[model samples]
Target: MQAYQVAELTPGLGADERREFRDRALSSARNPSQFTQLREIEGYGEARLSLIERYLLQGTPDASALAAREAVALSAQASQYAKAMEGRYVAALLLMRRVLLGTALVTGLLSVTSALRALLLWRSEMDRRARREARQREALSLASHELRRPLQSLLLASDLLRHAETQEQRTHLLALIEDGAAQLASRADLTRLNDLYLDVTLRPRAQDLRPLLERFAAPRVELSLPLEPLVWPVDGDRLRQIVENLVENALKYTDGPVEVALREVGSQPEVTVRDHGSGLSDTLHGQVFLPYDQGPRGLRGGQGLGLPLVRRYARAHGGDVTLAAAPGGGLQATVRLGQPAGTRAETQAAGGAGLLQARSDAG
Candidate 1:
């Protein structure tokens, strides 16, 4: 209505007012033909048709009224477009919300499942660690117990040495002191034996075991080996430890010569350490391999680690060590290495578990 009033007042306007109106209206538009100021209005159907007819018929258009009608039509059209755009925006927002809610639900489920798996793994690791720590403490306790006797003997012998009246008694006390000191040194070796024989790696190579056995031979030990090399894929140093422990045990038990023999029987290399003294009892065959499992008091003194370490080292290198009665008398300690199945990488990869795994296989 106001646009119509303006159209009517336009005919009465001075030239300056008309110029100002045209300038303001055309300012936002490029030119008359390109200008999009007017829009088609659906509700003004009859009036728009009448204007179109009048535009076709009239020689010159009633410009002010046409501009006013176009303005009114364009305003109505713009209002309808705004309403349609608002509806589209609201629909898009609802779709996005549903998608976001589904994504969040899936992510939450994944997180929960992952947390449960991680919890189970952590619990298993903690249990394994606890068991390992318990075994270590038990070993330390056994070593401490073994060390005590040798230490007490050393102190007692030194006191006796100082108070001895006869040179013969003093000499005997000095011998006792020497023996006790040697016992302490040998027993101390057991403390560090864990890293090599138990829960550790041993890099075995194809080498001769005969020279190693012969090298440990002494005037008191009757060494017997063939003139040829007794070669086997064995951890030589650890194998030497096994030979030394067996020979030392033999010499310690008997005053007579201890016999040490090395020979290959069939596919396996065999070692026999024989002493002319009472062998371990039949009941003690299995018991002897345990840590700090000392025999009957005063039979033979030891930290009791020799047999166990011997067995462990032998087993770790895919072999076995067993104690049994000798041919004529005394205990016979034998060692044999297991045949290689694969490579050294597989051995080290197993750490100490390979020893038990192989023993289980042998059994």
Candidate 2:
């Protein structure tokens, strides 16, 4: 269009000026295309400008008339190209806006999901903590109550010993005092064991368990063995405690004899203590294994830590303790020890003193 206007106003330009204008216009027309219509406009306009240049050189009316006619056609093409480009630009802007909206929706949904998951986890953790705290409080209360009886017995015996009048009376009072003192010492040992059982590690060694089992045998307790040194990797002191607690617990509830048996069940060592008295119900049996939960028959003269300690010590050796009703009429308690016992001891906390190498000579 500029070239057409220039030709109409100044058709008599110098030869050099006309050549320069023609070169500049042709160079722009040969450049790369942005749109098809834009390319077409440049090509068509270049041809019309070349025709006008020819008219300037020839100074003829026919050449001028042809240049004028081509000018009108070039103008119409430019108008259409402008409107087409505007419509394309609007369509591109709308597509970009839709893409942004979709991205925002997906991001919002993810944020809401993450927040809800965190809230649910927090509530679950809080509920678990509350139950644990309640259990601890109940256990502490039961322990305090159990300690009072032994303490009162000690105090009463000591008071009666001071008031004795005769030698015989003094001897009876002294025996009472000794008994009370023994009870207090036993209670103290149980309390200490309860605290250490979970935290302390096991000190297992390869040794015969027959001698240990023999220590508990008496007229009231029948012993069954395999007629060989039942050797296994075990913490002797812990095993002794386990047997003692179960035997004493049985004696406390029943007057009949208790049977203590030792043998290997599969690769693990097993100890079964069966009492010939009426066994506990299924519900009470389960409750007695919980710390300080002695059921309705609250562990006659016991702190209710016996079964719990037995189970914990057994588990520390990577084994477990189970209680079931015997076929005839009794509660059979079984304690199983883990295979390759030294492996589990490495992962647990350091335990109490090591067991003495000397086995008990008592039968």
Candidate 3:
């Protein structure tokens, strides 16, 4: 009966079907001995098993192991990517926190600096206002003192002229009255007041020099000639004021004679007022030219504006005024003005005239 059953099974399966069954058994086995056991099965032929090992199992072990290892490596790489994404998110959060803090610190510093700048500006403005007020007060005080002297002189002269007796004495009194009236008239002239302020404050303009000097020169003060006329572009009115002020100052401060000399120095013409008064102190020399600056302590009744005005006028003319100890023991003030724009012949002529005047004054 067993032999009959085997023959029936063997006869039912074809050769190709038998070979496919052997290959499946070999592929499913975990070890070489498991394939050997499958080969010993009753219907499995040794020849079919040998064909499976040669065609299917041969050269396939290494390929199968490599495929399994690649799957495991892919899983590990996915796990590492997940961890890296988490780390990057944490780092981004830390950077964002630092940026926010830095912005706040910078904003606070800027606010403090702006406040300090505003405080400094306010303090500076307050200081300027205080200084301006002080200057105005000083100016008013000096103007009042100056006005008082001239008013008193006019009143005294008027009173004297009213009571004169003899004709000769009346004539002399009339002359004094005329002098006082002229002085009063000068004080009343608004133009003179404007000029007085301008001389010390404003810039000078080009003007004729000869007529300007002539207008202010005292009638008693004589001038010499250089045989040729000279011309210059200068601040005429300011120059006149400076000359008049210096001459008047010389007459007021000293008992000896005074002289004014004009000469040409290269392309510039210079006016020098020399007086036999006590010279300025070496220590106070530079200070004398500043506005509101006073001379020596002993020089009374002077408001200390004369030399400063002269300096301002000189500067306006693009020139300067200097003080020196004169050879005759007095003050020598030299005011230099640049030569005017004109023909060479005209400039020479003007220079000659200035030279003549200088010689006349020197004599």
Show where candidate 2 strays beyond 4 Å.
1-195, 340-363
Which candidate leads in lDDT? 2
* lDDT per residue as tens, model 3, 1-363: 122223325767765664564445445433446433333341322233334334334435443333334334433444555566679889988976775565565566566557658878999999999987775554454344344544775677668768877788878767766755655554345445443444343433333355555544555454432343445555454576578667766766677777777766785778888888888877767888766666765345667777776776677666788888899699888888753233335547676665455444534
State in Å the error of residue 58, model 1.
89
Query: What range of 10 consecutive residues in model 1 has the weakest lDDT sum?
Result: 52-61
TM-score of each: 0.45, 0.45, 0.46
User: Which segments of candidate 1 are over 4 A away from where they belong?
Assistant: 1-130, 137-195, 298-301, 340-363
RMSD of each: 23.1, 20.0, 28.0
**Against the correct fold, how does model 2 do in TM-score?**
0.45
Summing lDDT over every window of 10 consecutive residues in candidate 3, give the lowest-scoring window.
Answer: 39-48
What lDDT score goes with residue 236 in model 3? 55
**Cα miss at 127, model 1 (Å)?**
7.5
Instruction: Let me know the TM-score candidate 1 reaches against the reference structure.
Output: 0.45
